[model samples]
Target: MKNLVFNKLEPGTNIPYELLLLADETVEAINQYIFDCAVYLLNDGLQNIAVMALHPNSNTELEIKNIAVIESYRSQGIGSILMGKAKEIAKENSCTILTVGTSDTGFQQIRFYEKNGFVKKGIRKDFFTDNYPFPIYENGLQMRDMIILSHDLSE
Candidate 1:
């Protein structure tokens, strides 16, 4: 936990993108949005431990494109730390809503986001089946739809 610095990764800076691929399964999918999104990194002075991708969907909304923490760092409050920063950044950027979309199979993620104040907004039908080239599965369940969650940044 020492020297754990978290901040937005500036453009043209050397960033270890492999850390992002950990959360998002495909390079193609990530590449489609990487440049358009803002990359925030969590590092311990020596190595990368977590990453969160945020993108502006509109003047009043920001979308969490992806969030991932290394296995060894998971459940150690790093993710929550990133969420805390995300909310702050959203407010600073004048965005009123923060949203993230996860697959229907993401029970743990749903709980985590809900615990952090996000509420279910809507669902994107066949999102996984249409987007991912290969079948996506988790916990022995096939991921079919994308459940979108939103948090009001107006507070």
Candidate 2:
């Protein structure tokens, strides 16, 4: 990851909709929170390799609304680095908890979050079906619920 830079996306700049859409399903869903969240990009000097969008849910809680590493960069520990950066940002903002939600069908994602110190907290039943306009599937399973996970920053 030499020459990689992690920085906040400048205000008034065009949003990286394609990158963000990797984690989120639709532009409308991203637009709902993108403006309210702080978006960060991980650039490898020449191009962007990852993105994370965080929102301050409360004074003590920070939520990761979206996070994605370019497909070619998967399994290279880049996602973990982004998770670490998310924790740092959460702590810097006086947050005690860092939370993220993913589709229950995303088995790899669930394991990834757990490996990063986040524990299963709760689930929003039918979250995908309720929020998304179309069906979402992963690993041949329909995505119906959102599995919420949390990492205690105070730890």
Candidate 3:
């Protein structure tokens, strides 16, 4: 698990970045609840650029609970690389599906996932209502629905 290029992120700041990226829990809850996660860094060790959360799924798929790239790191292909590592790990573990969920308002994330060949499989409306401290909006739209995306790793 540690063989991949992984780094350590400051707990509070990093968790909020995860929340902003996916509307997850606060930094505190994330620090306490979601313990199985990883961070990606540049080879130069300049930035803790990305985050990923790994956990067992109800089905055979492996859930990428969270993935994020800092704003300065966006548009540079770092997120894709991080996801590629996650997909590789999933395949190595004999998992057939790479699954993730994001708010409908996360337009950039939706585009990123779609660009990476993940398909929109389902939605859970109001998935973030009680989970986040404040309402989240993006691209002039409020994020109330959670969209589930999946990529078939077996293919």
Candidate 4:
């Protein structure tokens, strides 16, 4: 974890307002509690991505709240590495699970999480309706819900 750099995006600066509309307090609290948001620079051997706001869900679970990678640096397995690190940290702490929420804007992320072995557990209806500037769409379909995805670290 020491080698990874975590950066917090300014409350309303880095993240889209639509996202904040739904989870502002959660983000605020995470910014205050987490030591750092992890980032892997692009200049350093082709790995440029950031993972931020890791927080404890409880004694047995940890949440991966935010992850971002530069568009040019994406699809090169950087995200997988970040998720691996999160899993490692959770396992080290005896955490049983890892959880993350994806907005309707997180179109590609939905598949990424499932590809990494995460399963859908629930949904928040109309989650991004008020947050995204434009309507959210998936496969030409409008997204009107937020899905909760989880991976079991203990298994």
Candidate 5:
């Protein structure tokens, strides 16, 4: 973890737009949080490898708006690092729960969150079809619902 450096990106400044698009498909989708939410960029000193966007939903909860690691740098424990950082931040802010929503078809993402201590709580049906202008696909399956997962920060 010490090898990874995290920085809170400043608004109205340089944001890795291309890197963000890797996690969220549409520019319109990213526009929902890119400007207002807090964006954290993780770099390995050599390159900007990952980014996570956080949105504080309430005094006791926060949502992971977006979390993505570069294609080549994935599966290398980077996403976990970002998650840990998010947990730490939630604790500091006195938030009790950290939540994330992903496509129902995102099997890898579901596994990833569960492995990191998050549990499935609820789901939003037709989230993708209703939000995006076009259909979204993952693993050859058309994404239709959003699976909501949460972890207790107090634990």
Candidate 6:
């Protein structure tokens, strides 16, 4: 993490597609909300290692639309740093809640979010099946629903 820098990219700036694809399933899905979201890049003075995108979901809620760290950088606290930045942004915007959603099959992701102080809020049943043109699988299990989680920024 030497020379770590977190930079917020200008809206509509071209993003690192490969880095974003590490978290999202498809290009279409990534494009769906990216243009409207605030994109952030984490670099180690060499190359981009992680990305996070966030957008307002409502007057009081900010949603983490995408978050991904380079595969080699996982478990090194980069994701936690991104989550912490997201919370800071949410609070700065006077948002009361910060939300994120992941594939139901993302076991590690669920645990990661929980460890970051997010709590289960609800489920979007058949979200993947309804939105994605193809099936998505994680950890050998097919993805169907979306598990929505939220953190209380007001706290």
Q: Which of candidates 1 and 2 reaches a greater TM-score? A: 2
For residue 10, what is the lDDT in candidate 4?
A: 51
- Model 5: weakest 10-residue lDDT segment is 10-19
lDDT of 6 by residue, 57-140 (tens): 898999999999998889999999999999999988999999999999999999999999999999999999999998888999
Candidate 3: residue 100 lDDT (0-100): 89
Query: Candidate 6 regions off by >4 Å?
Result: none
Runs off by more than 4 Å, candidate 3: 1-4, 7-25, 28-33, 36-43
* lDDT of candidate 4 over 71-99, digit per residue (tens): 55468876787787778878987899998
Model 4 scores a C-alpha lDDT of 0.63
Residue-level lDDT of model 3, residues 1-155, one tens digit each, is: 23335654446543445433443546654554366654334332653556676666744678887676667667878778878888887887788999888888888889999999899999987977756668766778877889999999888
Superposed Cα deviation of residue 126, candidate 1 (Å): 0.4
Cand. 3 TM to true fold: 0.77
lDDT for each residue of candidate 5 in 1-155, tens digit (9 for 90 to 100):
46778999987777678888988988789988877678999998898899999999999998998999999888989999999999999999999999999999999999999999999999999999999989888999999999999998787
Clashes of each: 0, 0, 0, 5, 0, 0
Q: How are the candidates ranked when ordered by lDDT, highest leading?
A: 2, 6, 5, 1, 3, 4
**Candidate of highest lDDT:** 2
- For every candidate in turn, the CA RMSD to the true structure comes to 1.1, 0.7, 4.7, 6.4, 1.2, 0.9
Which residues of candidate 4, in runs, are more than 4 Å off? Answer: 1-48, 130-143
Worst window of 10 by summed lDDT in candidate 6: 10-19
Q: Could you estimate the TM-score for every candidate?
A: 0.96, 0.98, 0.77, 0.65, 0.96, 0.97
Model 3 residue 99 CA deviation (Å) reads 0.5
User: Candidate 2, clashing residue pairs?
Assistant: none
TM-score, structure 2 vs. true: 0.98
